[model samples]
Target: MGRPPCCDKVGVKKGPWTPEEDIILVSYIQEHGPGNWRSVPTNTGLLRCSKSCRLRWTNYLRPGIKRGNFTPHEEGMIIHLQALLGNRWAAIASYLPQRTDNDIKNYWNTHLKKRMKKFQTALDSSLVSNSSSSSQLLSKSQNDMNSTSLRSCSTYASSTENISKLLEGWMKASPKATTLKKDQEKEKPSNENTNVVGTASSQFTQTKVEEGECGVISHEELENFFSFENLNSMAWEKSSTDSTPQGSLSSLNDRFGTMTEVKERSSNRPAYCFSDKWILDEESGQVEDLMDLSLDCCSAPIF
Candidate 1:
């Protein structure tokens, strides 16, 4: 057998610690900064085992612990970091200053894991909704383009004299026109009311097309159709018509844009967010997967 248990079943106490025990442990730690647990009970005149004394100091009596409920953003960071790092609780705790690994581990088991699962479910639903909306928009645009193309072809087929010339010119120009149209479609938003649609359209045209193409009525027409100024004016008109204050769409867009950028960067590189090697599997004793993804090691707590 493996040597014998340290604390045998005799007068040794366990369970909820008493006030007297708390006071003794706190007093001992305050006076001497917790080096060896084996000597703690003997030196401090406490009846409890050295293991109990050490546990009390590490979990509760330590200074600078911000106890109580965690904020939503902090919870979010913890969940994200945990997924990347695994169960390396001490490492995870280091990122959250003043939080103990034991506390974090308990929180994860009791609360955060469930909350993260719910959040992930909601996120999946949102992604599905967005994808469905995008498909609907693309279908609508395709139908409209097919109808327009049919009308154009019929009109060209009617003219006898320039029929051959028109067909040759159209065949040559269609590919370029199709490319421009695809670019415009990609740039345009399903929600024409948003500032992004206009701004994105203008930028897309300016950067993707040459000066000559930019001058084309199709490009100019698209720009005018998707202009942010026009959308803002429309929003103001609607608000004025309704006798309500025009809600600031610009502010919402600004905040959303920043969040989107940060999310993109985080997804591209997870190492930046982790404080230590996250545990992937406790049973298997596996570490967090670290690929080529660039992590921001500067923000991580030193081991």
Candidate 2:
């Protein structure tokens, strides 16, 4: 007779596990550790079979478990490993520590298997066409040859195997070639740093000449230009000019005309009016809006 099951099938729940059951199982495992599945359902009072409990923990609830779409790098690894290992998903999962054997199997069956099959079909067709053309060329070569039997025994299957091998070799060698090139570039810069230093000095001299041409001002000159004395003199001159009746009228007109000029600047939309009077005046229209709201509130009777 076969060995008895770990847990009886009778009275065992078989659907998706509830959150409460998960929490209970996780708590029990945390306290007592994960092995000895025969006692887990008995201890935690979960209605699941031992197999289901173990699968849930290993596939989903286990710590450090990664659950999401696989990355491209991971997809490549899975395809390459699958080609090498065949249907031994457990062995493949050992290479991908984050992925479970079940997940890897499901993903391969659902996604990668179809893609690889389609690609294999295309590759076979192309190889067949290439082989037929090569056979024609070989036959022509044999006909041209005198008294010599020339045989071309290359098959489509052999050609496909050679191509796969060539791709594998290229994949292995590409990284090493890139690293060697990068090292050569890095060494060149370090060995010829004198040119870099010379270029930097030349750039600094060019900047100095540009500043001279642009009339660069000294710090003292800038300070004198914005001095308090200069400011007071300018203010006195402006005040004296505004003291005249015509100048006062012209200044007032200019102040009032600024809003219209701003409006005219943007013909498609109305420009907002902004002035010192609107900002600095204490009695603006804001008080009226507040008063209107307060009056309405006081006049209305609340039930």
Candidate 3:
């Protein structure tokens, strides 16, 4: 049999910590610095066990610990690290300066993991379809752009202008915790209203040879850029939480008057289709799903 447990439960205080206890723990650590856990309660005059004291301090009361939502870049990093390190929270926390091991663990369990399980079936089909047809789909987007005129629509924003603006918006906007329509309308930057729809000479046209140009878009490149595809064989589940992808995709065929297609299918939901022209009349805002949808880049309000 194992040795007796470290502390007796008979008189030990338990449950949520009190303000007085928190103050005592803080004072002791500040006075003498954090050392052995077994000594914290003895020296600090608190009723919590050493283990409890240590956990409380490390996970909650620790200085500089950021308690809030994780940013997209940070979320991407966490997903990448977790893939590499498994569930090693401490190892994962090292890369995130302000987050604790407990915090990252909790976030993974409560938010991302559950969503991945929910969408596993749909993602299996989307992943295969998208990975194989990336080039063809993009070529179609280019052809459509050439044949179509610049049009603006919202409810079904399939026009070339709408696609460009929406793609640009995702590239430029900050990652939000909420995707509600009202909040997004208020948050959209007014300066971004410049029409991105134009010929190959359009400012949005991208070139790899140019310094600022992102060149063409590719899932292979994005897979590498994201650096965490395995997701423990749940690789099917991409970045669903904190859906902020870095940089932006430039049409690889920008030199050929082409624009790239947005993956309409997210692990979260069905994707929207973007082609050169809208099926609707010039002024109509309603969108009809076109042929061959892939990933869904959060576009302008499709209300």
Q: lDDT tens string, model 3, 210-237?
A: 2222233343553443322222332332
Q: 1-303, model 1: which lDDT tens digit per residue?
A: 886665564666777666567666655654454567888777877777777777766666544454545543334345444543345466456456556678778766656554434433443454566443433433443343344323322222222213323333443456644564466556443433223223333333333232222222233543443233443333333223321222332332232333344344332332111111121121122111111011122111100
Model 3 spans with C-alpha error above 4 angstroms:
127-303
Candidate 2 wrongly placed segments (more than 4 Å):
1-8, 131-303
lDDT of each: 0.42, 0.45, 0.43
Who wins the lDDT comparison?
2
For model 1, what is the alpha-carbon lDDT of residue 263?
A: 42
Q: After superposition, which runs of candidate 1 have C-alpha atoms over 4 Å from their true positions?
A: 1-4, 123-303
Residue 213 miss distance in model 2 (angstroms): 78
* Tens-digit lDDT track of model 2 for 184-241: 3443322232232222222322332332311233346434532334322332232334
Scanning candidate 3 in windows of ten residues, the lowest lDDT window is 273-282
Q: In model 1, what is the error at residue 271, expressed in angstroms?
A: 16
In candidate 2, which residue pairs get closer than 3 Å at backbone N, Cα or C atoms, i.e. clash?
A: none
